[model samples]
Target chain A: MSENKKSVFNEIIRPALVLTVITLVTALCLALTNAGTKEVIKANAEKELLRSKQEILPAAEAFSEEKEEELNGKTFKYIEGTDASGEIVGYIFQNSTPGYNGPVTALVAIDTEGKIVDVNALDLNETPNVGMLVGERDFLDQFAGHSGEIALTKEKAAENEVQAVTGATISSAAFLNSVNEGLAQYAAVSGNAPEPLSPEEQACPDAAEFSEEKTVEKDGNTYTYKEALGEDGSLIAYIIRTESKGYHAPVIVLTAIDPDGTIQGTATVDLQETPNLGSKIGEEEFMQQFVGKSSEISLGTLSDTSVEAVSNATISSKAFVDAVNQALELFPLVSGGAS
Target chain B: MSTDKAKVKEVFTRGLIRENPIFRLVLGMCSSLAVSTTLIGALGMSVSVLVVLICSNIVISLLRNFIPNTVRIPAYITVIAGFVTIVQMVIKAFFPEIDGLLGIYLPLIVVNCIILGRAEAFANKNGVLISALDGLSMGLGYTIAMISIAFIRELLGSGTLFGVQVIPASIPPIMLFALPAGGFLVLGILMAVCNRIAEHFGQPKAELGCDSCAAYGRCPAKEFEASQDEAQTDADRKIRKAGARAKRNEEDRK
Candidate 1:
């Protein structure tokens, strides 16, 4: 019996039996622990969510219980924020969007006036020192007390323009998308489904294919380029966007180049150039100067005229011409429309 | 009574300095380096490990006779992982802050070689009381090592101790100390300091990491197999008997 047990039975069966006993006892202990802590864990998670909602909507003293709904194939939880008088003041919702490095989640608060009260990113994890800066004060503060259609810009424009974190456009866009998701969810809940976007509201609204982001380096400045495919899958146009020094803040221009390498059109997308003087770059007469010019188009002296500079707004005119020149230089790369 | 007390004291206190888990023995370096960035994190991890180690030690010691040597590792694992889960649940319930600080490392204590080493080397050979004391003292040694590293890292990296501003505002904290590279730098310097002090006291040089484990140079786990000698046991005897009966029946038919 001793020999039999030593050879096989003791080695396998006995060990298995002992291990089974240990595992069974361990399982019982863990089951007890789970039973004891299950409710507290749930409570802690709920309490954390509530605190986040309160922070996003600072003016709201209290919040209603979560109202869950399915929108765009994602589950959204919305809580109504109430004031001291118990009157519903705003709605806060959490939204998660794919960020540059990971999934970005944020709590968005929009008041009764359809203005974004604030946005608070929850446990943001993005590329540190760059993309992660979206959760910082300077970037997030841009969302406060804003109304109307909101968009990010590097330069300056009129109503509802927020400056994005420089060099972190993707992460900033993720944050913006997070807020937009919340807005869409809230709009659905309030039965205020927004109208479908107009053609102009779409990026390259008339194009067949979506934009493939590209960039060009010139004169110590980076010109962001987006290319679209025309109907029947041909290279359509290259839209060059760049920021250049103007009378005040930087003037931002979007210059379009045809596949054959000539300027299709120029638009002053956003500029903080001085009003009436430097702002003339956005006007048709000033932008028209480079409509047919190629990469050869240079900002002529104030009077010397190949493409005449904007009178008294030379700096702003130079900014416009610089964008067109960047387009002209980049046109060859995508000239065959194969890129 | 006095001699008995001294024996208990010697067995327990040996783990504190002579066989210190982190500084001298250097087992479980992964968790020590990862979570020692903040004092709170260090303290939280240490206490969690303390509970699991002590409990697992006592359990393994009590079951020493019942567990076979060949399958002891797997059995030890089951016991250790069980305690770690319980620790995780308790921390999640009552100490959510520590739960967040320790993150994945809390449950990772199951794989910590320190606990496994002690179980195989000391617990399985000793009584429950002696094993528990070993676990306590070793856990304390690990906790002290973690706290020392965290104290230095936090103080220099953030210019704060336990999240409170300590250094004057004018002295900007060195940002590198908060990073993983800084963790390695601090641990290396502290280890050197520890070894130098040990050498001054006439102690042999301590091995780093699992090398110090008693089972370090032993055969791999596959050696636990019974293939070393295929001695005919009861099953082989049954096969041999069945073969003889078949041969005899064939002879009678012929």
Candidate 2:
């Protein structure tokens, strides 16, 4: 009888004992680690939230707890940004709007006077390097100054306009909708409608006059470049207008170069690059890479991750690079003859 | 006493060179390739993998005698997966930065062949101390392989080592090494180098396969075992109940 009981214990009780001990050991270790790190994890999460809020509203030294409210049809979470004295300097609105593939999220900030403080894109899940360029600083930073109606444009921006990322009109429109939603939300909560930019606040706000225009035919295309002077009659910029053959047809571009040889900006007069094989060259994101560049642009980049040849549109991409290089070369001639 | 100590030393040392998990056994190539794009990511992955490997090895070795041969692999994987999850949580809590660097590799560690292979081959048959040594030895070998691959990848591909740039920006870092294609190229050449060095030292070639499976010749014996399971007296039923519990753990694994 005792022998039978011993056999049962060996078969069942001992095996259960070993497994139980192993489970208990693992559980205890995990529990201890969880307990030890609980406070630090909570603190890190809070720190991250405050940091994100502060990033969009740099005028504020701290941020209040998030509070949500409905505006229009969408819901938005807002945090009150406080200065050293604890006065609400601005409101940081956390908002999202559906884009091409996913929701575009942004932290849009507005101050007491209804001017945009800054914008921090929290997430952008569009096409890589193309639609995703909406999250790029050069693009989001376009929303930093203006408030009220923001319109997307391919031509030179007026005071109330923002350039859309090239090859990503849908994503750009979605991002614009997200920021416009934030502005509207600010107006609803603050009960003040911010005014749009004035006519004097155009892209070249200091421009006084355009120089005599000249055209040069180069590489199977015609280049028309001119100089613009400041209000004080000093050489302000060189606006170079040219056309190059894209994969499908010929497209025109107008680029503004600072007299110092740095590109102020590039505007597509017309673009026929994307929807087939996208040469994102005419997009604001690609042109933004050349905004401060003085050297002749090339197809493959050595240093910049922001600069890339648009895949499947290598020919169109090379054509755009050559066009930009041609403008950079023409900048010298325009400035030398500026009077 | 001296012979026992020598045996222990040999078991540990052989994993480092003669049967390195990456270069010798050719295990865990997927992870080693993916995470080796950056030194910090590779180091983070190796450390996390090392933690799970050592913990699971010890636990499995301790429970070795109680587990039935047919249910052993399932039991081992359950324990390994549980530890892998806990390690990821711990990394998230303590070193969230390294946790981010680890990215998908944290979950991928659960499926790493080296961890399961070592448990099946060595730990299940070995003593507790020897099993722990095998885990440590195998883990260190993995670490060596990861760091070497990462060092080349990061330095040449991104012009950085451990996230610090040592190469001048004027010299373009080869972007190929940063991509998956470059990973295989580097892994192949390095494996060849490690092989040559091992040959120079007269290390015996590692025999690779599933020969160490406890149920190696028993694939066709499943029906026989089930019949035996039924015909046995009351004691066998109790053991079968434990095997059922092992199946439940296997379900939890998915």
Every model: iRMSD: 1.9, 3.8
Lowest summed lDDT window (length 10), candidate 2 chain A: A196-205
lDDT of each: 0.79, 0.77
**Residue-by-residue lDDT tens digits, candidate 2, A250-273:** 656666788788777666654677
Tens-digit per-residue lDDT, A192-297, candidate 1:
7766532212323346774667766656765567776678877667776766677788777776677777666777665678888888887778776676666466
Worst 10 residues of 1 chain B by lDDT: B213-222
Q: Per model, state how many residue pairs clash.
A: 0, 2
Q: What does candidate 1's lDDT look like per residue over B123-241, in tens digits? A: 99899998999899889989889999999989998788998989985897776787778889998888778777766655665565443343344324324334533443666878999
**Each model's DockQ?**
0.43, 0.13
Candidate that would win on lDDT: 1
Model 2 earns a TM-score of 0.58
Per-model chain A TM: 0.53, 0.50
